[model samples]
Target: MQDKPENLSREYILPDGRSVTVGDQLFRAPEALFAPREVEAQGPGVVGMVLRSLARCSSRIQLDILRNVVLSGGSTLFQGFKERLLKDLQAAIPSIAPVKIFSPENRILTAFRNMWITREDYYEVGEHKVKDI
Candidate 1:
C-alpha cells in the first residue's frame, strides 16, 4: 500500500489555493474513499463482507453482475487479499455475471486523474501541469 503513489497524479487546485500534484497527493488518501459513512458495511468486519459477497456467486454460470470495482488505499495490502477477495466474491455473486477489480496499482488516483481532466475540459477551471501545480 505504501509503495503505491499517494496521488500518482497531481494538478488539482485545492481549496487552499495551491496545486496538488499526482506524486505528492498520491498517498494523501481521504476517508471518504474507503467507504461511505452513511452505509454500514462492517459485516463480520471487512473479511465477512468479502465472504458474503463471494457466497452469492457460483461456478455454473461464471456471471459478472458486479463490475468496475477499484480497490486502493492502505486496506488493499492485507495478507491473502487478492485471492481471498476473488474466492469470496466468486462465492457471493456467483450468478451476477462478470465481477472484476480493475487495478493492481493506484486505481483510485487514476479515477481522480480522469475527474481532474473532465473538470478542465468541461468547466475550464481544472487545467494543471503537474510541475506548475
Candidate 2:
C-alpha cells in the first residue's frame, strides 16, 4: 500500500464501521507548540518559553545552559522536534551563543531519574523555595 500524502485528508473506518476524516489537524496540533498564537493562545510558544527562561538565568551561565539543553517527555518524542528547536533558538539567540538540544532515546525515563524534588524537602522549604531546585 502507498502512503498517503500528509497534506491530503484521509478517512479511517472505525471498528464499528463508521468513517471519520482526518485532515490538517494532525499537522497543526503539533505545530501549536511552536506557534501558540496560531491556535489563539495568548502567550509565547515552546521556543519563546525556553528563551524567556534562559533570559531569567544569569548571563554567565546562559552559554552553559544552551550547551546542555535536554528535551524529554512525550512532546519531545515528536519527529524533528530537537532540530526545529535548535534551529529556532539559533535564529533567535546571538551568533556567539551556541545551541545544542539533546533528545535521549529513553528521554522520559532519563528526565525522571535526573530531576526530582523530595516531598520532605518540599515541605521543609515550601513551594516557592522548592521551585528553584
* Model 2: colliding residue pairs: none
What tens digits encode model 2's per-residue C-alpha lDDT throughout 11-95?
8999999999988766677788999988998779989999999999998999999999998788888667888899999999999
Candidate 1 per-residue C-alpha lDDT over 1-133 given as tens digits, one digit per residue, 9 for 90 to 100: 5455543555889998998655633333332223334244333544355445656778443233345455665566543455556565656554645567655676445535533444455455444443233
* 10 residues in a row with least lDDT, candidate 1: 27-36
RMSD list, candidates in order: 12.1, 7.1
Q: Pairing residues by index, what is the TM-score of model 2?
A: 0.68
Clashes of each: 32, 0
User: Residue 25, candidate 2: how far off, in angstroms?
Assistant: 2.3
Question: In angstroms, how far off is 114's CA in candidate 1?
Answer: 11
